[model samples]
Target chain A: DTAVSQTPKYLVTQMGNDKSIKCEQNLGHDTMYWYKQDSKKFLKIMFSYNNKELIINETVPNRFSPKSPDKAHLNLHINSLELGDSAVYFCASSDSRTGFGEQYFGPGTRLTVT
Target chain B: QQQVKQSPQSLIVQKGGISIINCAYENTAFDYFPWYQQFPGKGPALLIAIRPDVSEKKEGRFTISFNKSAKQFSLHIMDSQPGDSATYFCAASKGGGSTLGRLYFGRGTQLTVWP
Candidate 1:
């Protein structure tokens, strides 16, 4: 069983286009996060939501917005995507109840802004 | 402003050899450290984790050695096989506050195990 899953494993879009990526977790985790991995394989956290409430917002650009409709679902929407935005976006979740800090990640969505 | 720093951008190990990856963090509040392994076209999965209270943790061929004073941690893979080749990441997180449960990942080390 897949603990976390993301849609559109591969995304190709032109510059200035808007895009959205969907994520779902069946692990019943209370905290969800969005991470971006650059070409050099540097992973950085963008946003995090706990119990459907925004908790951590990193230094990400305002153009990227993360929405958590529910505890099990978190979506990312990018407005006016730029070439620098091209990277693999990963969605992850962890059970805040345990507080052990073990996160399960999704397959990742490779977004390419040409 | 990189919270976690990992060394050796790439590593090559032969079968039946030992592979070690090191990481350091400046956050004294970080109590949980975990190592993740990722393959091509796949997401990273937790291989092993260690708490600051413990100096070491071992699971099968994977082991995590942690030093609280130095805020440094390392992952050792014993008897690495060809299938063990992948990208390894070291991550740290604290317990409470707005940053709670947020993981700070390393740049990642690409391991190539030759059979």
Candidate 2:
């Protein structure tokens, strides 16, 4: 079974439209993260949730919000999507107890704004 | 400031050759270092990782050389094969935070192995 999974592998929406990407992890990890990879292949962290508590929030725009209902799920909602929002979004999870923790990434969701 | 910087935006190596990619970080608090490999249209996967306490780590054909004093690290791929071609990323993080570990990724280096 896939450890970490994401839905809506591809998204195409008009400018100013709203969309969401859903993520789920089966590894029983307490921490989940959202990362964005731009056209330049530069990956950057956006937000992180640990056991349903928001922990890390980067300098992302207010239009982008992350919601985690529980430890197993974290979803990203983007409102008023702009052209610059085109990128691949990745969901990852890791066990917090391990000192050498490494993130397990899910197949990304590619979002395109036109 | 960019927390982590990586060199060689891309690399091409012949089969059986060794491939090397280097990275440096500005934060001394970053004690955990990891390298991730990504294939086209897929998510980046952790390949290998090292800690500041260790100078080197080897996993199969992949090796990580770390210099704690300089705050630099590198990934070395031995006997690189055509199938090993992919983008590699070096990341660092301080593991004790509430988020578990929030990583700062380097701009990926695309590696191509010529058969």
Candidate 3:
């Protein structure tokens, strides 16, 4: 079974379109996170939720929104996407009880806004 | 300020050779350091990690050397193999000992092992 899985492995949309990527983890972890990796391979955290509570939000644009309906699901929604939004978005999860936890990452969704 | 900095944007190594990548951090609060390996079309997977309390940790052919005083850490891969060719990222986080595990990653190093 895929421990951490993401839907729509590839997304291609026009500029200013709206899109969403869904993430689900079966590791029974308490914390889920969203990250963006740019063309330069710089992976940066965008948001994090612990048991459905927002814990971390980076300096991402307002167009991006993260919603965690439950401890096992975290989804990212983006509106009016810009060309610069093109990047590989990754979903990761870690057990909160583990100190210095090892994060399990999903395959990632490659988004391209033309 | 970039909290964590990694050296050598890219690296090339011959098979069976040793591969080393270094990282430095400016945040004293960062106590846990992890190195992740990523292949094309995939997310990064944790390879090895270390805590400030330990100077070195070894896992199979991978080793992490940490210097708490200098706020620096390095990843050494012994017996480099072409299968290990992937982008490697060094990351650090605060409150890791307490479970506030949000990793701040460095610009990844593209590692290519020549067979």
Candidate 4:
């Protein structure tokens, strides 16, 4: 079974379009995170949610929002998608007690803005 | 300053050779250090990790050497094979009473093992 799964392994959209990427984890972890990997391969944290409450929000644009209806899911929605926003988005989860803070990652969703 | 710095953006090694990637961190609060491996088109996967208390940790052919005073750490892969080629990232996170936090990752090093 996949520990973490993300929908739409690939996303292609036009500018000004609204899109959402869904992520779910069956590991029953209390924390979920959204990350963006740019073309240069730099992985940056965009948002983090602990038990359905937002905890960490990086200097990301307001156009991007994350919603966690429950602890097991965190979905990302982007409004008026811009070309610069085209990048691979990844969802990850980790249990607070793992000591090593080991994060399990889901297969990335490649977003392309045309 | 980049919280974490990685060296040798890329490396090439022959089969059965040794491959090494190094990283440095400036935050003393960071106590948990881990390395991740990523294949193209895939997300990064945990490879190995080490804590400040320990100078080194080894799992199979993968090893992590840490230097607390120097604020540096490195991942060494022995008997490198073509299958071992992948992008490797070294990351650090706050420990102690700190809750699970987002990790600070290095720019990553691409390893190519040629047969």
Candidate 5:
């Protein structure tokens, strides 16, 4: 079984479209994070949620929003997607309550905005 | 800003040789350092980690050598094999009860082990 999983491994859409990427972790972790990997292969954290509470919000655009309905799921939604939004999005989970920050990552979703 | 800086965007090694990737961090508060390996069409997987308290850690053929004073760490892969060829990433996280899971990752180093 996959510990961390993401839906729609590949996403291709046009600009100005609204899209959402779903992520789920079955590892019973308390924290989930969303990251964007640019073409240069730099992994940058966009948002982090702990127990459905938004904790870290990087200097990301307001058009991108992350929602955590429950501890096991965190979904990312983008409004008016732009061509610059094309990148690889990865979801990770870690149980910070245990005092260790070892995160498990999902397969990643490649987003392409044309 | 790029908190972690990795060197040699790519490397090529022959089978049974050694491969080394180095990284450095500017934040002195970072105490936890971990290396990740990623293969094509897959996410990164944790390979090994070390804390500032220790100078080195080893797991099988992979070894992490750290220099706390210099804020530098390196991953060494011994007996390089073609199966071991992949992209390696060096990451660091804040320590001392701070936001622990916010890892600052390096650009990454792609290793090619030719048989």
Candidate 6:
């Protein structure tokens, strides 16, 4: 079984459209995060949730919202998608109890805004 | 501003040779440094990690050299093999507080090991 998984491995949409990416982890972790990787392979954190509570919110646009229903699930929704939003989104999970800083990432969802 | 900076955007090494990737960070509060390996079409996976308390940590063929004084760290791959070719990313994060488990990743280095 996959430790972390995301739905719609590849998504293609147009500008101004809205979409959502769903993530789940079976690793029994207390912390979950969303990260974006640009074309240049630069990864940046967008949001983080601990035990379904918002923890870290980076300087991202208001159009991007993250919702965590439970500790095992976190979803990201983007409104008025722009071409610049075209990138690979990754869902990661880590156990705060370990305090080892080892994050397990999902296979990633490649989103394309045309 | 980028918190972590990685050098050698790309690297090529022969099988059985040594492969090295370097990274630096500006945040002194970061205590945990981790290295991740990502293959094409797959998400990143933790390769190894180290803390500021130690200068070096090694696991199998992978080793992390941390220079806390210089705010720099490097990953070394010994006996490099074709199977080890992938993109490597160095990351740092503090242990606790509002930013707990928040990782600052460096630009990935694409490594290609030729057989």
Q: Which digits, one per residue and each the tens of the lDDT, describe model 3 over residues A1-114?
A: 999999999999999899999999999999999999899999888998888988888899989999999999999999999999999999999987884348999999999999
TM-score of chain A of each: 0.97, 0.97, 0.98, 0.97, 0.97, 0.98
lDDT of 3 by residue, B6-115 (tens): 98899999999999999999988876798999998888999989989999999999999999888889999999999999999999987643236688888989999999
Q: Write candidate 2's Cα lDDT for B17-47 as tens digits.
A: 9999999998998889999999999999999
**True-vs-predicted CA distance for residue A114, candidate 3, Å:** 1.1
* Residue B32 error, candidate 3, Å: 1.1
> What is the C-alpha lDDT profile of model 4 across B54-84, one tens digit per residue?
9999999999999999999999999999999
Candidate 1 chain A has its poorest 10 consecutive residues by lDDT at A96-105
Maximum-lDDT candidate: 6
- Clashing pairs for model 4 are none
Model 1 gets an lDDT of: 0.93
Runs in model 6 deviating more than 4 A are none
TM-score of chain B of each: 0.97, 0.95, 0.94, 0.94, 0.95, 0.97
Ranking by DockQ: 1, 6, 2, 5, 3, 4
In CAPRI terms, model 4 is classed as medium
Of models 2 and 4, which has the larger lDDT?
2
Candidate 1 clash pair list: none
Error (Å) of candidate 3 at residue A59 is 1.1
**Least accurate 10 contiguous residues by lDDT in model 6 chain B:** B95-104
- For each candidate, the DockQ is 0.78, 0.64, 0.60, 0.60, 0.61, 0.77
Candidates in order, TM-scores: namely 0.97, 0.97, 0.96, 0.97, 0.97, 0.97
In candidate 2, stretches whose alpha carbon ends up further than 4 angstroms from where it belongs are: B98-100
- Across all models, the iRMS values in order are 1.1, 1.9, 2.4, 2.0, 1.8, 1.1
Cα displacement (Å) at residue B27, model 2: 1.6
lDDT of 6 by residue, B2-108 (tens): 89999899999999999999999999999899999999999999989998999999999999999988999999999999999999999888888788888888899
Instruction: Give fnat, all candidates.
Output: 0.74, 0.59, 0.54, 0.44, 0.46, 0.74
Error of 2 at A1 (Å): 0.7
